[model samples]
Target: MDKKSELRRDLVSGDWIVISESRSKRKHQFAKKEKRIIVPRSSCPFEDPQRSGNKLPILIYPEIGKWRVQVLENKYPAFKDVKGCAYIFKKGPYSVAEAVGHHDLVLTRDHNKRFDQLPLAEAELVFRAFKDRYEMHLNDPCVSYVSIFHNWGPKAGASIYHPHYQMIAIPVVPPDVEHSLDGSVRFFEKNKKCVHCVMIKEEIKEKNRIVFQNKNAVAFAPFVSKEPFELRIFPKKHIPYFEETSEAVLKDVIKALYFSLKKIAKNMKDPDLNFFIHTAPIKNKKKYHHYHWHIEVIPKTNIDAGFELSTGIEINTVDPDEAAKILKKN
Candidate 1:
């Protein structure tokens, strides 16, 4: 079949979404649950990364046998090194470019243990690796933005059961990030304050939407949550770059992240979740001072229907205040 994928724009939000009718299946097809098959340790490729044909790790912690956390080149990368920076060209009326960038995996030692299951010290190491690699990728001239994200369970798009995170450095800033940056800039122009910082202050005062907090970090269900059980973790202080955050603050942020995930597992019954960092673009440092770096954790609670597909708006079944109350109890 010919590829029938096209990008459609939402006039209200100015966001673009792919509409691929060729990829769609019957309505009942999505409801059928496949049997959860666990791949054995013997067949798991991450067991011995080097032995399994992966290149030597770019960064490894502990500097000893049985690595705790390691960063390696992705065997099957969505983006790869190219001769020059990405160049845009017109094909018919649409613009296209090469997928030139860096893609790597952050692997942990344990196959069964997820991020929330790891000890606090071990969990902190993961974020350390993320920051280190993020800074490294930012140095490249081709990279405009670096995305650091984790996917848990099959529903959240984790193909391999082995616990791992991914970093993708792309030439173009993603549309979602662009929209968020635009909103922050607009808010700051009018109010002369960071949008996220304002939200943090209100959330602190309200106290109902807070899930967990410490001296440096706070996690809460967002006031304008797009999905059920959506949670965001932000640094109390204004920070534009995730790579430039202080070690002390990052540790506290990681603690809040761990606590939030633990609560979700207990209260939501181990729902598949995706967590990712959203910060300023790598290219511009000063322009996005109004932006605040943070992490968004979205559980795979509901799927989009026809109405949601046609329109850009989401229909969240749970309220952020009630979601926070449930999470706080856990």
Candidate 2:
């Protein structure tokens, strides 16, 4: 009989993902170098966002000449900022609420340079802009959570070739995030320790799955990785809030992410990827002290087919250990 596939449950989210090494005949088969779409700068909206009909930037770095990063209202916002808080009411048997929130874009100056290719200083500045905008939304009466994410390449949902990130402040905690928060709190209550910090300690000790690590942060292919080459970055210390992260710790986390992305591009054949920050909710901050904030980087290496769609379980073809080995190579 052939060896059976493993069902690995995520430590933090409690979601189960199938790890079937037999799905791919060879290691190289897992590398799907997604084609890069090059939109001419002349036609790119981000080149001159104001001229391209975007709202004036809400915030800009350097306050003076030659802005390096700018945050502007998303031209096509999924959530509109209405006059009042989104209130839940009954629509017969269903509950309904106004979709009231804010959506913004953080754009970098160079069209050609993606996050991995950005200079360390410029990349850090990008995150600083995110922090500034996140802080701005903290006072909003309608906002409950803020999402910060970057989609690179078309597969990763980057419609425009110009590199940009998105921040959406919404009225309620999203279901996926809620699951993670619930799971982490449950673990903390039971064990009296942060779940992510425990996982980080194990990964650091094991070293098999670690992709990159600096003085204050570590990036690794998660043991229960839901997708091929899936990686997570965490501050070595237990930090529950992204906006409150100290400058020294944030720089190390940024360095870990910067190095990991470069390795993914070099070793994994430049596949399109999405990276997002996961932190405690903006409201009731004290209730989530047990949570440990982190970044999840998922390369577009696998698509959810029928099994995944029907079962809500992702089938990851590549083993995370092997993925880490490949990415760890110089």
Candidate 3:
């Protein structure tokens, strides 16, 4: 594309997104206008997890008599723990493998308390659960990567209204992760430095795109934001493994995360969003030492229209600097 239709390459994934200034709309116009579809508490499956036919929680943290947060196997999982090792077999010209892995849900007790609304202590507990589950799945011989993510509203792929997070351990590294790993490796080989760390330094120096930061963690609107108000949170120290992070550092990271989400809710008019952890793959820790683990929070501001779907190039209307300015407001 031409300069007016700027194609920015993602530093980690190396994917190009077209920022078409020609097709740009007002930043405020991207705010969500739809009403959230609230599922009743009585019919919510996560209200009483066991009574809803869910298997007993693998891990439960009880506060008094009631559970504060619990980790349980998903009732309907996308991937299941099969008997044997996951194998790649040929179906004529195509190759496929059995989806042999683990899918679990980390659920909070309160139905109405979103991550941004949760108390700081409770939010920290949620990350503690994430680290616990991530470490648990990393031990599996068949697993290559574990993905921890949360979907907020229906548009962001939340089928249930109860606030919950999901962890999926897969036998192979996903394409997006593969691309990111490749990009990081290439950058490290050429520059001998972590790309994300470099970005963090630059963002800190610039201070224009910073949303929030503490001693241990920083959150900012990425320079190459794929969507409007795309915020990324990173620990100041370059750690490739999320599970290895300490509770104090994790609390700092979650604090930045909560701050980002709260700002997004207020600035974007409560848009649906998806936040996920991007860390080094479980099987190749040494190879990804130069990589940095972080969380990317993407607000569902626009749907994939014809151009985006055809070219894999997202069109972000709002500038990252503008987004940061808006989010920084009280």
Best by TM-score: 2
Worst 10 residues of 2 by lDDT: 28-37
Q: What is the lDDT of candidate 3?
A: 0.88
Give the C-alpha lDDT of model 2: 0.91
**Steric clash pairs (candidate 3):** none
Off by over 4 Å in 2: 1-4
Ranking by lDDT: 2, 3, 1
Score residue 182 of candidate 2 by CA lDDT.
97
Which ranges in model 3 have alpha carbons more than 4 Å from their true place? Answer: 1-5
Model 3 per-residue lDDT tens digits across residues 159-207: 8999999999999998877888889889999999999999999999999
lDDT for each candidate structure: 0.84, 0.91, 0.88
Per-residue lDDT of candidate 1, residues 1-330 (tens digit): 563445544321345554443544532232224444577889999999999999999999878877899999999999987788998999999999999998999999988787999988889989989988888877788999998999987989999989899999999999989988998887788888887898899999999999999999999997667676789999999999888899999999999999999988777766778999999999876888888999999988678998678877565555577678877874
Candidate 1, superposed: residue stretches over 4 Å from native: 1-37
Q: For residues 157-209, what per-residue lDDT tens digits would candidate 2 score against the true structure?
A: 98888999999999999998899999999999999999999999999999999
Quote each prediction's TM-score.
Answer: 0.89, 0.97, 0.95
Between candidates 1 and 3, name the one with more favorable TM-score. 3
